[model samples]
Target: MKRIAVGVALLLMAATSAIGAGYTWKNLNPIAVGT
Candidate 1:
């Protein structure tokens, strides 16, 4: 049970990190284009 919980937490962290990176890139593009 402890291992499963840890695995789930790691998975969530990775997923959120990936999502945040993609989102930041998306937000940056328009500013880059405008410049």
Candidate 2:
């Protein structure tokens, strides 16, 4: 059970990082294109 919980936590962290990176890319893309 503890191992399962840790796995889930790591999965969530990875998902969150992926989402944050996409969000940051979206926000930056326009400025990058404008330049």
Highest lDDT model number = 2
Question: Could you tell me the lDDT of residue 20 within candidate 1?
Answer: 100
Task: Give each model's whole-structure lDDT.
Answer: 0.91, 0.92
Error of 1 at 25 (Å): 0.8
> Model 1, range 1-35, lDDT digits (tens) per residue?
99999999999999999999888887889777567
**TM-score of every prediction relative to native:** 0.74, 0.78
Q: Which ten residues in a row have the lowest lDDT in candidate 1?
A: 26-35
Q: What is candidate 1's TM-score against the reference?
A: 0.74
Q: Model 2: residues >4 Å from true position, as ranges? A: 31-35
User: lDDT at 23 for candidate 2?
Assistant: 85
How does candidate 2 score on lDDT? 0.92
What is the alpha-carbon lDDT of model 1 when measured against the actual structure? 0.91
Candidate 1 Cα RMSD (Å): 3.6
